[model samples]
Target: MSLFRREDLHSLAAPYALDALEPPERVRFEKHLKGCDRCAAEVRALSEDAVRLAWSAATPAPAALRDRVMAAVRTTPQDPAPQDTARAPARARATQLPPHVWGTQPPPRQRERRRIPLFVPFATATAAAALVVASLFAVQANRTQDELTAERDRSREIAHVLAAPDARASSGRDGRGRTIGVIASATEGSAVVTLGGYGDPSGGRVHQLWLMRPGAQPRSLGLFESDTPLVATGLGTSATSLAVTVEPAGGSPQPTTQPIVQLALKSVGFGE
Candidate 1:
């Protein structure tokens, strides 16, 4: 006989073997297996293996844990008194008080009383919600200030790499003897890198720029789209140099090829 015509049953076999199937699926699978001898045998073997694995992983629970759990379970539950049943008689008595007080007054013209407005619980809840939302926004504003400080530090590092004199110049002829592009204008926080007249690399390879700071490793700025100008981001304060290299379709942790462009940045007024 065919092993369980239901595709869902076959999908449930592994979970059933592991005892992870929910109640409905487990019952249905068991019914299906009664007529399918091959599936039944396979499931039996898998179940045994699962039991063995669980037994190997089993460890004794702490002795006090079970006692504490049972103590909590044995506690009696308390029910609250119903509000309407408790308040109905009190409301009736309060209404009677007004009538008795009116009888004791000297005259309607001489006795004057003002009714106080009742408080609305919903209005109080709405005001509380508004206060909570305002507090959350205030916290977010403070977090943004901290993020801006970190971004400024990154910008300073990128500026340092662009100022190096020994950095590889982006000028020269390509393999085809045509003029290759040159990267120019290196500075702290921002730099003007060049993409030249040569054709872009093939096979999904793209150029990537990096900011290498003194005592710190290089960090990726972004991918350099072929035929587009080079720009960098996240330059930290006191960054000493810049490098550009060929990377995979996405880019890698380190430069995979020689840097096509390089620039050195100066440290002057970096902290400011």
Candidate 2:
């Protein structure tokens, strides 16, 4: 049948389980339930939910409730449906009503019991959507973890180089007279530099660091985001100059402005 018709059948599961559907609608849905595994499962679950809700609201009935009900029954005649021929006694109504209501006897339209396996397309679609969301979250978490790990590894390496027994460290004033500090490994070009009192950059500008050897051209380390210390690996061990210049926010191929502070090393020192 059409998809809309199938969805309609699924929609009735809750009302059907609660005995809220009209007799004819109930009969139609029961037929749908026999072949539609999803509807049957849903109806069964809804029925259980209803039972739990009912029990949660349960309390001891008033002691005189049965007597009061009987008195009301004795004085009041039951109203009958206009379509029903004659009202059956309460006990006989069980057999007289259609199977859709009482469900004690087989209805003429469907007598043979048929087994249908449970497979719900809607439930499958929901599960797939959940899996996709979960996969996305897992991938994001892994990427965040990797970024944190890389930062920690960088910090450790910087600490090791600065703590070396043979690591040479020096502090002096730049042309700006702002304090500049340097600690370079004796065996390698591994180094850490600290800068302070160099105010913030103007809009569209960033501070860049560079290393210059005796006769070689100055090499760019990278852009600095903060006045905090920075670590540079694989620098020239013979470098005698360190400089910071204001450049485009992303930095430049060469210095775009005069150095904010330039420290010319007396010696690229420490025992080598």
Candidate 3:
């Protein structure tokens, strides 16, 4: 019933005991172990196994060494007066405390000597996670830049085609006699259009473009936004007209709502 396999859960015990598992995954496993006796037992056994290895590998000290250390410890006198501690003693300078304890004396210089070895694995994993996040943001930024570049190029191309020698344009009126423009390259079938100030679509609907030949079914081009100049290509050589209609967001195979505007292209020699 769990999302991950039971074997996968069992395999995490060693890493979990060593504090190597990442959080959230580690937290989830801990929660699961509360109910799963088998997994809990396996983690305990693995932890004890590590302790057993430490015990087995330890070397025994000589028998007389303990008595000698005790005698030396007894002869060393303890400091009783705190006010006489202004002098730096040679014995204090020579003493070396284990690294795990906080040193009572200041270091000769203030600086990082080295990183702690225990944190290396976690630090590496955190750095890797940060790098992966940065890469994803970089990719998204690049894609957005590319899209803007392409849009600028497209606007420039539309302007060039409109200014070309062989290009022509036409206009058509809606039921209210308001006009929309269609401009195209007479030879290449490239065109730009205006939506003729049609109102926005209702919810769950969109505006669609079509290429129509006289007395024939319209071919769907794609979707468009209102009142903006639409740039299109691949208009059939026989298409003498174009239309805009409302449809669902994905656009229909055929016009589903009544056309809001129609442009007669024959007069402009579009797709001829």
Candidate 4:
């Protein structure tokens, strides 16, 4: 004689009406419903749709026809329950709850969050390292370029001096006061001298170039053999006159013989 609640109707009547119950459960529900008027009414209401569902499923119709038939049917409205009634103002409920009560606790430790794979930091580090390396290489390449430029300039200066018209003029008096063997193309500098067309000196002694300045002592340039027309030796930059003298096998601080060759350079402004 108890009335069946909508909540309990699904369990008590749905299985029997849908034919999903076992034979024993079906028999038990049928027996209980015989004296139960509330359950019988619930079953009758549900049976109307249950019979229609079974009939439609058993008979297959054309797809277009089925769609037309289904379009004519309307769904039934479901009754709300106690829980549904309370859920009417979910936003209000949320606002009433404390911030801590929700799952809004401070984030987990950094180590735990990093468990998921990511490559942002690693990619950034790689890019930065590449940039640094590129900058370093660029600096080194510039330095090498500067050095090469300087060397090229030095070589060009040497070539220019060698090509000058006055570079080959050499004049001097021998020990006998004879204006002996004229040499041409002589280039002189503070530390070195170069002469052309001067034959080699005889014996073990080598030819040496000296510079006689106004008041300073004669400085020894380097010793040089004269077999080749070209001769290069170290001399002082303060010399006013360029002289070549025969010296001992190595060389001497002073000229041992009268200058076999001499060239007085005209007054010219030389710049460093």
Candidate 5:
């Protein structure tokens, strides 16, 4: 019975292309490759990736490391020659042989057989290294993709708010003349806050946003560090304006400092 199933054979293409399979497995996979177009194509693709990855990651070996390896190679002792079994006395050979002239029996002290060594071609070694680096690249690419997806979703929400029929914008400047603007959409019940030239919040603090009302505790919108635009949702009709205050890092549950910048939302009929 075959040790590998049909589906199992396909998985060997990468290792085979990389010359990482054992001799027996290699022979079986080679037989499968002859009849499997999909496996053949995959092998070709993996081989190509291996080649490209090798060239991209190749670096000259350090002189010190190379010198050390060469020194070890030169100083290493060669293995002693194998014993001459034929030189053994005739009396010993007869005892080790089968009793009958034509019989097949085990010898008393047969030489130990050595396993065929695994040989990795230079190209395949490059492929193995490439596989390691490729895994790392794949992880980074996935993280970058996730970031792009998040940014895209945020942009869509901001666009939705800006395109509302009742959308209106309010702008004001801080004591330092850094501009802060809010576009509130009554229909969408959300606001997009934009900042310009609003350098670091400074003094180990973060810029916090609040929704202020006549007779209510200020509602926290979120925290800001840079000039990145933020979208604040749940803009109820009672909120009169948006305010910015500098608070300790990580921000506070409530406003700790007086407002440095405020943009009245009345223009968008938010408090009405």
Candidate 6:
């Protein structure tokens, strides 16, 4: 049961989703997945993303490009054989006698320079191509790992908010017909916000969350896109409500439009 720590097994989700794990690692992760719902969910999400990325990146090679390359190969002249440089000329050989026969040091034999094979250039090109591919793969893997790590952190924060001693949940629809759900915790001074049926906003506008108080100006909780959940913290004691408004692309210091939805954070009783 303790063969692999939870964190270690959790880190394998991306590799498992991509089918990049070795046989043993794959076996371990599969065993871990059965008992770990979070890991299983992550693997499923990553797998779907991987498939989309693969399909999007797959471009068919030009049909004529191969024929043109083959045609060029057929017409290209082969390189001439390299001359044998190891042998000395007959005259030079005749001038130098064996050290034993001449009783003198035979002039130092010319150092033989190694000749590079013609296939070496092709090998080098292949190696360069391989390096480029490897670098691209490394960048992609790092990006995926970063995304997964960020998601895990966000989930942890949301979990903390939901588990707060005095947390309360509320849900309502925005002006644009998107569902906004909020779980606010006075004890934890934070809230977890979730958007349902979220998509790209029209009119080049963005949705912004605000922290509201009775007499003070609304404080921005930052702009958001897509359906990703957001965790808002640092509500302090003065904050009384959470509101979402549609604003310009970069967002406004104050809400330019009316709130699509609002969740009251009055003590422990949160309501739409």
Predicted model with the maximum lDDT: 5
lDDT of 5 by residue, 113-197 (tens): 2100111222343333222211111112123545555544555566567667777777786543357777778878898886654
Worst 10 residues of 1 by lDDT: 110-119
lDDT ranking, best first: 5, 6, 3, 2, 1, 4
| TM, every model | 0.30, 0.42, 0.42, 0.30, 0.45, 0.43
Ordered list by TM-score, greatest first: 5, 6, 3, 2, 1, 4
98-123 in candidate 1: lDDT tens per residue?
A: 22122322122211111001111224
| Residue 100, model 4, lDDT | 24
lDDT of 3 by residue, 1-272 (tens): 66668788878888866556777667667656655656665675566566676698799888799999999988975432111112112112111211111122232332221212212333343333222211111112123545555534544555555655767767775543245666687676777775533545789688899888777888887676533456778776688778888899889999987887777787877544
The local distance difference test score of each candidate is 0.47, 0.56, 0.57, 0.43, 0.61, 0.60
Error of 4 at 143 (Å): 36
Per-candidate alpha-carbon RMSD to the true structure: 32.5, 31.4, 32.3, 47.4, 31.0, 31.0
User: What is the C-alpha lDDT profile of model 4 across 1-272, one tens digit per residue?
Assistant: 43545445446775655666666555556546544555555565566568788687676568998777677654533221112112222222222222222222222222312211222223443333222211111112123545545423422333333344544333444432223221222334422234333444667878887666677766665564332122233333344666778888888989889987776643321121
Stronger candidate by lDDT (1 vs 6) = 6
2 or 6: which has the higher lDDT? 6
Best by TM-score: 5
Per-prediction backbone clash count = 25, 0, 0, 8, 0, 0
Q: How close is candidate 1 to the true structure, as a TM-score?
A: 0.30
